[model samples]
Target: MDNINVSDPPARITTITSKKLSAKRAQTRIQAFLDDFENRNSTLKGGDKTVTVQLQKLNQALLDESQKRRKSAGEGR
Candidate 1:
């Protein structure tokens, strides 16, 4: 071969989103719940409050994030 030229593209970083993190957390929670369900002394009722609080927090955080993204997007116009 006389001559050859080659070049590689620049690397780019990937971003993580809430949806994917939520899915992962859901899977982990299901696994934990299943483990608890198998225990003889497990009281699911006690965890209901905790779960409810967690859900509310997550919901609020997601809503806030969405609102921020919307405002930023609108401002771009």
Candidate 2:
């Protein structure tokens, strides 16, 4: 969980990263954030149009980050 700015409109949520953590620990952390994000996102989608659009942007940023990480990791291997 990082870059959480609820005060500002179009809050940004980015990928959860753990430095030097075990694979299991990293997975657990990511899963927890995703679960929480989904719950909140559901509510946002139902309530406000602007907020929903922000969530969509955040979602796409997350996906892009994940893809970048995976590609970099594969290159290292």
What would you estimate as the lDDT of candidate 2?
A: 0.65
* lDDT tens digits, residue span 1-77, model 2: 68877887875888698468544455556666656766776864675557545655665666666778888999999
User: Candidate 1 lDDT, tens digit per residue, 1-77?
Assistant: 85544575657889775454553455456556645654643566354456545655665566666678778989999
Which stretches of candidate 1 lie above 4 Å from their native place? 1-48
RMSD of each: 17.4, 9.4
* Candidate 1, pairs of clashing residues: none
State residue 29's C-alpha deviation in candidate 1, in Å: 16
TM-score of 1: 0.40
lDDT of 1 at 64: 68
Estimate the TM-score for candidate 2. 0.40
lDDT of each: 0.59, 0.65
